[model samples]
Target: MLMTERRAVVTGGCKGIGAAIATRLEADGLSVVRADLPAAAGAWRAGGGTAVDVDVSDTRSVDAMIAAAVGLLGGLDVMVNNAGVAEQRARVDAMPDSDWDRVISVNLGGAFRCTRAAFDHLRASGHGAVVSLSSTWGLGGVPGYAAYCASKAGIIGLTRAMAADGGPFNIRVNAVSPGYVANDMGGSLDGLDAEAAARAWAGRDLQASFQPLGRQCDVAEIAAAVSFLVSDQASFVTGTVLPVDGGQSNRLNTGEQQWPAP
Candidate 1:
């Protein structure tokens, strides 16, 4: 089926990568219900897409978001689990339990809630698709950011499990692990000094000078990756965490890519 005729739901579509993905999907002809923080005007700008306020960590909010998407957009053919949070950058020992819980609630818990709520509708789609947002931080090790890394890593496991569960129903579940992008909400970096932020993110020793791509990724690139996965092009793909990060995951000495921010 053409993407325009497909009904899709994209969480966290208010800004950054999520918004980019939503815009691309809409441009491809999909009818998208873009959900994000209440009063997010950017998400609504995705042409014909409808933007709804949704907090994925809450069960009722997620359910309502999905219900509205299905009822208004006609039925869910795609679900993009993009809503997530990053805990304050602190060592595990210094990280407060409250902060850790909050990260889990939004990053891990949010994905679980949204996926669960959309399962039946997606399963009914016959050839539905689910694209989750993950990060290299989820892979491992970032000195000051334990909760964020752990939460993102947990999402990988969750995505795989969902893939297994959705296989019988012909629904595809996959994830995209993106690296540093231009506009990021989770890290609060827009206000930082560019040089300091770059060093903090890339490290003085590793320097990131050798980074094959030589620069941070753009959000639109992430959207293209997601679009390919949702389109018929990736028909055989499922349960895979494809890193849209310009080979950093592969080139970062010993296949290690650290989290962009704490």
Candidate 2:
């Protein structure tokens, strides 16, 4: 099918990576429905796309979002589960139960809700594709991010499971795992004071060295991966977690000395 004829809905499309994905898909000629909190509806409208106020953590909101998207677009071709939350840095023992629940509910549970709500519409389209945002930490592990890691890892598992079931309906499901990307979510350094922030940013440079590419990823780069996965070019791709993490997922931090000199 032609890209221009396609219709898509991107969760958390008000800002950050979600916004980037919405813009990228729109640029590819798809009619996009940007879904985020009710507070963000105006931003979506300003962008000249169909806007649906949705809180993915709530099934009712997800249902309404999908209905609105299908109604407005006439059908659904793509569903991007880009809505997620990050927990404050904490080990499992130190992490609050509330934080864990919130992260899991928004990250993993939200994806499940949106995907389930969009299933019927997607099945009807016969060319449906879903891209869930996972994380490089989900594939591996890192200290001080227990809940966040668990939630993202759950997304990867959910993506594969959905792909297996959705395959019969001619729907393809995939997960895009990204590394550190500059967005509203920022990185672990978020919320630090100027001096501490500077120190953290410098530390990030040391961390980036672990990634063979030696740099942080851009939100648009991640969006481009989503574009390809949902496009016809990836028709045969399904049940896969594609890491857009600049080799971060494949690397092990032996030491700074171990990194090849640029």
Candidate 3:
């Protein structure tokens, strides 16, 4: 069947990497639904795509959102679990329970909820695919981001597990682990003052120096990676975490190196 006949859902799809993924999927001829937080509904400026508000952390919200999306699209073929959050830097001992819980609930739990709610729709589609967003921190732990790291890492494990379960139904499940991306969540200083913005760029420069690519990733690049995984090109691929990081996953940080804020 033509990709134009397929349907997709991208959580947190109003901005950043999620927006990029949604756009790429739509460009590839898939009918896309951009699901995000209720407050972010107005942030979707793109046309020709359905936008839905969903708090992935809430079971009722996720279930209802999936129902609505399926009702709009008639069925679901791809599920992109991209809604996630990161808390500020803090030592594990100093990290508040609220921070840990919220991050896990939104990041890890959100992915699970979305996938579960959409599993049936995807299975019914006969050729289903799931792509979740992980992070470089999920692969190599970073200082002061225990909750974020753990949640992302859990995504990898969940992706593999889901892949195994979906194998019998021709459903593929995978993850994309992105390193530093030039986005608002990745330290972009869009609203920051001159000094803060400079500092942010300086930090990116320093990190880029250590990274083999000598630069951060573009949201479009990450979107492309996801695009392939959900397409027929990766029909044989499943249960893998594709690192969209610029070889950052291969580079090792020295124990004494100063780390970025979480």
Give the TM-score (vs. native) of candidate 1: 0.87
- Per-residue lDDT of candidate 1, residues 144-212 (tens digit): 888888888998999999999999999999999987666656757656899878866665225344456
- Tell me each candidate's TM-score: 0.87, 0.92, 0.92
Q: Per-residue lDDT tens digits of candidate 2, residues 227-254? A: 9999999999999999998888787777
Off by over 4 Å in 3: 45-49, 186-191, 254-262
**Predicted model with the maximum lDDT:** 3
Q: After superposition, how far is residue 207 of candidate 1 from its true place, in Å?
A: 5.6
What is the C-alpha local distance difference test score of each model? 0.83, 0.88, 0.90
Residue 188, candidate 2: Cα error in Å is 7.4
Worst 10 residues of 2 by lDDT: 182-191
- Regions more than 4 Å wrong, model 1: 41-49, 190-208, 254-262
Residue 161 displacement in candidate 3 (angstroms): 0.6
RMSD for each of the candidates: 4.8, 2.1, 4.2
Instruction: In model 2, state the lDDT of residue 174.
Output: 98
For candidate 2, the per-residue lDDT at 34 reads: 90
